[model samples]
Target: MGRMKPQTLLLQSKKKKGPTRIISVTTIVFGSLILLLFVLSLFTTYRYWSQRSRNLSGNNDLEDFDEDGEKFDRPVYAILDTSKGSIVVELFKEASPEIMDKFFHLCKTGYFKGMLFHRVVKNFMAQAGNSQRVEAAEDWMLDMKPQNELMSTKHEAFMLGTSKDIHANKGFDLFITTAPIPDLNDKLVVFGQVIKGEDVVQEIEEVDTDKLYRPKSPIGIVNISLRRQR
Candidate 1:
């Protein structure tokens, strides 16, 4: 009977352990599921914020614009004669007075003469400036007054803008959009739009460029001469 009693206790102990093991396994599985859900929630929130950040920074190609504003009639124009060809840009004084003031000063002073169209971002913009201080060395753009914050002008195809990008140090130069870049409306101040020689503008856009968008062959601004339009 003593031996039998010991054997009976052993069987009871084993039976108790069965339910404990089962409960432990259930709790571990529940915890694993909770952890997975938490990770997924974090991933979803990160994706949402990442997209919003790209839109705000104007760094992505996602396109949307509510208004580009009305077209304006102006009497002045800029002639950008490049190695590729001559492109005419209309200066709308009513649309952007402050921006035009800066543009005119730069143009009249021969700031763009012989400068390289240094960078081109496919489907975005083509930027031009003196690679070094040799061609457009004055750097007078640094002393210019602040750009208009409330300007309503929109950045459309062939439009000339003053933004060199937040990362760029040269606001002394200009850029041309190959397409309507509404994302830049807030970041860039538009001074003019191509009124003629759009084909020339497109030709520049199609030029073969290095990975950094520098033209394989130098495409330069031969001169930028401003004149009055009838």
Candidate 2:
């Protein structure tokens, strides 16, 4: 007993740490690393979204018809054939020439013939495009690294959504404004209006939607072609 007492005192004097202390220290270090990673991730996301928002105004119209013939300037036209019905959309070259050019090419090639409107928000709008195209656009956006600048256009009725608006994202999909949401004015680009078959849009909206607002049934565009409504 005397010898054991001496040994215990010696061990105490050495200040040996227990398993719990060692585990606690390791956990603290790991927690600090995790916190640092989270902060970095948040900062990166903010910077990405911020860059996308620069030069971003909601008033731009992606396409529309010039009611008055006085303005001869017009953008290229592309007609779309949907399961609901046919729709005609007029383009706007004055607002965005580059985007219009790309759109025209995509249409002429029939790239969006069978694409689906993968996403639809009831009160907001419908979004469609080529899934592969969207991914490619996002990659290009990250590669180019756009600067901050406000678009000098107005958002009308069915203006198209560009990769820039959603952050260097593009696809064959598009969306139509359900009703006049005052808050979206001059913020989202309005490219065109529903020339015909707006009822289809209504029917799509009426269907039961999910949390993301996507409809239970698929809304597919059977075919798309260009036409002059002279």
In terms of lDDT, the best-performing candidate is 1
Give candidate 1 regions above 4 Å deviation.
1-74, 130-153, 164-171
Which candidate achieves the best TM-score against the true structure?
1
Candidate 2 lDDT, 105-213, residue by residue in tens: 5665567777777666565566676444434322332443222333233433444444345334544346665554343433444545565656777666566767555
C-alpha displacement of 131 in model 2, angstroms?
Answer: 5.9
lDDT of 1 by residue, 1-230 (tens): 33668889999889887454345888989999999999999999999999888655333221231113433343666788999898888765555554565555566566778888887656667778745422221222233234443333464578887753423554566778786654556556677788888888788888898755677888889887766542
**Per-prediction count of colliding residue pairs?**
0, 23
